[model samples]
Target: MASKYRRGFDITRDSLRVFTREPSLILLPVLSLLAVGSAFAVLTAIVFQQGLVESLVTNDLYQYGALFCAIAISSSVATFFNAAVVHCAAQLFDGNPTSVRDGLAAAWRARRQIAVWAVVAATLGTVLYILDEKFGVVGSLTRAVFNLAWALLTFFIVPVIVLDERRSLRRQLRRSGSLFRDTWGESVSATLGVSFVFLLVALPGVALGAVGFFVLDGILATGALVSGGVIIVAAIVGSQTASAIVRTALYRYATTGEGVGPFENRDPDTVFPES
Candidate 1:
């Protein structure tokens, strides 16, 4: 267990190293956020114009439908940018110069595959959301478990979609699952370390927000709130970018028995022992 934690921390550190080497990688997540925000804004406008918002608020079925549509669209937009990030990460791993434009172009080339995967992911997410909303404690627990499982299973979907676009969506998902199962230990470790890092990153924002709520007033309080929001957003974007880099490295190591950049010293067999 200690070894697993240590390994995860190492992976997380290396991921950060990769990001620092190419600070522009952060742009991918920022772009993703903007794209998703725009999509949500458009969807919200349409929903309100059509009076679907009222139905969504009053009717459970309508709410679910609206939520599903939102999830589908947001997931597609996120996946598109995520694919780009993975492409950039791969390039970084290969010691090649890459920019946000390069990543976006790569993702654009795989837009159709991303759309298919997004639909599948959104359907599963909606089902889980319904389970959590409609059922009691049991449903909530089931949804939580299933959500984690879904994340684990599809961990490599972005890398696969970006690197192996010829594969069918189902096959891509299967490949992702296979790769994850083989490197579950490293995956869990990397996730644990990343979670810890995010928590630390979020703490300052939380503290500022709490101080503003309890102590500050007037412009000072508003400034605190704004600063806190910025910190939180930066943390989220940095964490996401680091995670994509780590996952891309892991996928490359698992598939090719080779590592790149900070991962160069990591032995594939050690990370994912032959089983």
Candidate 2:
């Protein structure tokens, strides 16, 4: 059994490993671009929803409720696609020998599970948003920590659903969650660490977008538009690459005994049942 508490690995180190081991993982970068683009579209929809709700909810309470519901549905769909992309990237980077079409196909195959997970994640976020608005909970450190912990804890769920074809939804989630629990610190460190680097690389683009906005007097200037667009694309690509790395790490740990604990104890016979 995987000891679950294995250490000495993280996202940054894992990413470094991938880059060094297989620099030809071009699909990761492409997946990142696609994921980020989809995210941008989803964000735009949410923003538009708030504006629409404000404009249309002057007298009708039901209209406001309906708008919010629509936004939630749209957000969930975007999240499902994003999760799918992450799974695809992970499989590709892990030497799964798949294409973008394979990634999409994987998502389609696991659509139900992905959709369920999306709704759950979005509902959590929405609840936090509600609390922030209704009870002035925005500054609560506990809330912040809760959100952070939840995000990291469930990081492996989608990838598990996408990559583990032999298992059903319940088993896949349970197994992934268990694997993650055993490797919690490592997972968090790697995920957050890589995300930080991505943010650092993206910061300059954000600054340029800000300059564009100001230079254009709050209107979208050419520079701002270009900068923002580039930043978004970079974010997407980075995300996809990161997903591939995480998937590789988990799958390896699960099947090949790459990490600490249960990973090492994996039955070689079970690891490659077909071989």
Candidate 3:
């Protein structure tokens, strides 16, 4: 059937259905982690090779703080790219016939945008930190608002960047802003839902970590690697799942002007609504 909707993204009930049907589809997150492992390895090497950590450990508190700040900035960049890749991966789960390689390539293609977002995020964070440091006026509240903004920005940043939309960042941001205008509540809820699942998965690991610390009198961290790995994996799952949900919804919403109201048994054809 012919449709008037633009060929873009929409969040929908069927999107979540796709995620639920194949929760393991989040394994894309794990693959993402592995793909970025070399980056981590390189960072580790830099820290050791340059004796930065050693210098920080031997120096005053401010030096340690500088090291941590650098790490935070770098991690934020990695996170933006990772989220973009997960967005692509979610497209595949939504039946877009996209592969992990394609997702990675797409992520690379959109690297500049992701990097720009990272800088924006970092600047916001730094501002928050500075405010907290200088005045200490409602610092927590300030940080919370900043974080919420960041989260909302993340909701459609990747999808907008990935879609073959020919628009300036201002226009993309405007469109993404419009898409989430009345739906921030739903976005936060969906985020919490996925996060809760990861928490459930990580509970055992948390318990193990606590027990290991107590049992070893803080001498040995039993299951350190295992538990850490599990926590990391859970993080990956949550991220990928959220990406899948958001992209699917965006794709649907863009096409049909519908929020994925509720999950219903749906075929790709029904879920997508002919465009």
Tell me, by lDDT, which candidate is best: 1
Q: Write the per-residue lDDT of candidate 2 for residues 1-275, one digit (tens) a residue.
A: 12121222234345545444334444545554555557667755875876764644563544445445554565455445545555544554545655556556766777777666656665666566555555665535556876877766566766676666634556765767776776665565545555666676678888777778677754468858797868866775665566555555655565455642222333322332222
User: Residue 156 lDDT in model 1?
Assistant: 87
Ranking by TM-score: 1, 3, 2
TM-score of 1: 0.89
For model 3 the TM-score comes to 0.68
User: Best TM-score goes to which candidate?
Assistant: 1
Provide the RMSD of all predictions against the true structure, rounded to 1 decimal.
3.0, 8.3, 8.2
> lDDT of all predictions, in order shown?
0.82, 0.56, 0.55
- Tell me each candidate's TM-score: 0.89, 0.64, 0.68
Over 4 Å off, model 2: 1-96, 138-142, 165-173, 216-221, 254-256, 259-275
Q: Which has the better lDDT: candidate 1, or candidate 2?
A: 1
lDDT per residue (tens digit) for residues 1-275 in model 1: 55655565676678778867678778889988888888889888988899787788899888878778888898898889888888988988888899889999999999889889888888888898888887889889999999889898898888889997456987998999999998887776666677777777788998998888889999999989889888888888777877888788888878886777446887644653323
lDDT of 3 at 70: 55
